[model samples]
Target: MTLTKSTFTGLVLEYDSGIVPPPYSHVFRLALDWSKGDMIADLVLHYTEREDLSEEEILDEGFTLNDDYNYQGPLNSVWIKPLQQLYEKTRWTNKDIEEGGITVTPLEKGKDEGVKIPSDQEEWQLMAQDLIQAIYETVKKEAPLKVNYRSVQGDEIIDCSLTVHFSNREVIFEIAGKSRQINWEYAIQLMKIVFTPDYHYELAKEEAGKKRGAYIDCGDGFWHELGKGVVNIDPSFDAVSKIRKGFDELISE
Candidate 1:
């Protein structure tokens, strides 16, 4: 939309990069002086009156305003691919999991086609740790982390919500309106089993147990832990058993 110099004053244009969810909008301000034949463009990200992402991150990853005087929009395209990758990598949400396990996908897939992992295992772990910490904080300060994990039951597929309430050194699973608590240490271990990159879950055709038809299993560590138990694992057998039951009952309606 073109306007006279005076009309363009105080004009702000919003671009929906489709990077973040709703209630978050990133906008661009155009200081156009058509009469004087001068214009300046600046990109700004905000949610309501505040910005959830740091200014530094946005500037570093998001596209800057065009210096070309004739430049025009098409702004709402998927332009913030870098930022999208960052969000998908460093965050764990309901979208990251399916059938009670993490989805297998590339973490980086950065600008450089040859680049993949952001360095080494330590860096990957650090990013994972940050996501885990954010989950803990949300559970502690905000609300319980609620995830709707999908279940495959023979010919039926259903999604069920699992709520994790973290407090002190333990976490509780509220399932079927009943709550079961386990040590934070054990919770972390289970998360690793579900979120590890080595696993590629495929629903088994044959039923293994009452809920096995719904909860698919494929990861090696998952089976090893169930078979003879890991050599170094000295888990509370009763608590582990209870955790299994809770997960199985997740799809129970």
Candidate 2:
């Protein structure tokens, strides 16, 4: 028999988390299929976070698989070995394949049009390294300084200070006299969204005839906005541009 690789995207694997109180449910992605029987299947898993859930709610609700797509197949017993191999090769802990339901459907016709899955831990590390390097280069021009900005917190204008230290891979932000250290990867992503040409233009236009600050929610638990007379060497802008460039290069590779 000829071994072939059948790649599936958007496959949801649902299982029981073995938790009481609400009987927590868990979901994972089976992105690839590599089997040695009739067909070999390799699994690529995706990670997700429920933004609508609070910490306690998430713990109670358990894990949830994406229900956007569905899969249908006659799961053969011969495929069990391959699935077990996959479990050992990756981060998946449980071996209860029978308990976890797997669905396979045609989500993408070509590789180019495939779904944009979440980055794996390895990929995240590489991206983090690139972001740290880029931020380091950008911050070198002005070391040990703080930039001020205005942000809206519950309908109030608040002052925020961004401090970049050359020795660390984190950006320090002081809001309401409380300091938080945001990692380079997260800060880069936030800046990319806020500093985009369209978003920046819109912010400028909206603030042209208004007193309210133009703010964008970073979605990482912080709101960033431009302050009056902020300097030309804004770290956010520099880091965002570098991140965009790095991402483009990564994709091309």
Candidate 3:
């Protein structure tokens, strides 16, 4: 759907509702002029759900409810505006898959492109919006999930919001609820490309000394590079390494 001025605000509101309390649902509201008279704001929400609910139930709530609120930030508007522009100029196709349902054409890289953006405005917006929707769905699906997180120093978790525009980079992440921690596989996915191997090595060493060392620390570029090719561990690399000699070879090779 083409996001008009009114619709734009509604999108933000809907997304925001999924994170913070009502009347302050949105964590970030991003507005962009794009040299035009009108403005567009991309809103983002962060939520954490429990194992007791269904995805449908989560959607109905429209927000994640956890005992702790660690994932808090001013949603960066600068990132959203450019993403909107990039989406406007791109082309993306969706097709029904043999497996079932529909699949989005994976984003591709262009040669010397002008800031590789999302394929289509509507489709991209759908992802940002659907991230909340997906979480709601996952909550319903009863997937085994947990999170471990760190946040600003405070006695209580505080809700936050951010509005950005024309920024160079955008980042999105969340904190796991208390007693909930990130699965090593999923955490690795998020951390792979964002951090360097050396950084990840250091993080691994640091986390190894902790009680929950079963979770891999994909800090730095580890989050971003996960999809490309990298090994991940649930408990610890050393434990996994004993199970497979290829682990050392893979890292060095």
Candidate 4:
């Protein structure tokens, strides 16, 4: 197959449970943006042929047998109509479909190419640790709390046994895993105070679980730790009151 100017997108699906029955098993969707025209239509019509494959048959032919490339053969078994309704107008062209694992490059006459990683692993990890420390201190002094940490990338979610220590108006949260660290600083900033008793009671009820998982989990865990007196928070009520007083002073002036 002589693939001219083309763009390919890769999508990876990693199901944690591995054996999820029915619809839950369907994990991810990746679209390859084909630059020229509808490749799917060509495949249907048998228009393109593997005519001039070079010595490296696999590379020149532009196909791979790797699981990543195939991604369980087109997600057809699971994707159904209504949910999977793709009309001709809405249907993906050849350029839009991609195997989960294959990296496709597009050719263009005058296109600028640039690459950047979202964030450095080391920096994010350090920030995660700092946030963890802040959570620990705030809970310890104001609320009194204990916590365990867990993180995941790809399909592996591993637990990190974390403990916090504070000194010189500074706090630290430490964990052993890889050379890479967690983004604890942002985690701490994003933490919210939760009432554990309230959370437990709410979790027992069916109403709470219906909302999104992230929202409920964050709220429940945060308050549960708070109500249990397990962690301390800076800017306690007293501190907030003082800040308000200062603001009021400034306004009066």
Please name the candidate that would achieve the greatest lDDT relative to the true structure: 2
TM-score of the candidate numbered 4?
0.18
- Model 3 misplaced regions, further than 4 Å: 1-77, 92-204, 207-253
Error of 3 at 229 (Å): 15
lDDT of 2 by residue, 2-111 (tens): 11124332122222222322223334333322222332222222333345556666545554344122232323333334333332343322233343333322232223
Q: Once model 4 is optimally superposed onto the true structure by TM-score, how far is the C-alpha of residue 13 displaced, in angstroms?
A: 55
Instruction: Give the 10-residue window scoring lowest on summed lDDT in candidate 1.
Output: 107-116
- Tell me the lDDT of candidate 4: 0.26
Q: Compose the digit string of candidate 3's lDDT tens values, residues 57-112.
A: 65576544432222222333333444455345555444322221212221122111
lDDT of 3: 0.30
Runs with alpha carbons beyond 4 Å of true place in candidate 1:
1-142, 155-162, 198-246, 249-253
TM-score (all chains, Cα) for each model: 0.26, 0.27, 0.25, 0.18
Off by over 4 Å in 2: 1-148, 152-155, 164-167, 199-210, 215-253
The lDDT for every candidate, in the order shown, is: 0.34, 0.37, 0.30, 0.26
- What CA RMSD would candidate 1 show? 20.0
Worst 10 residues of 3 by lDDT: 159-168
Q: What is the lDDT of residue 33 in candidate 1?
A: 17
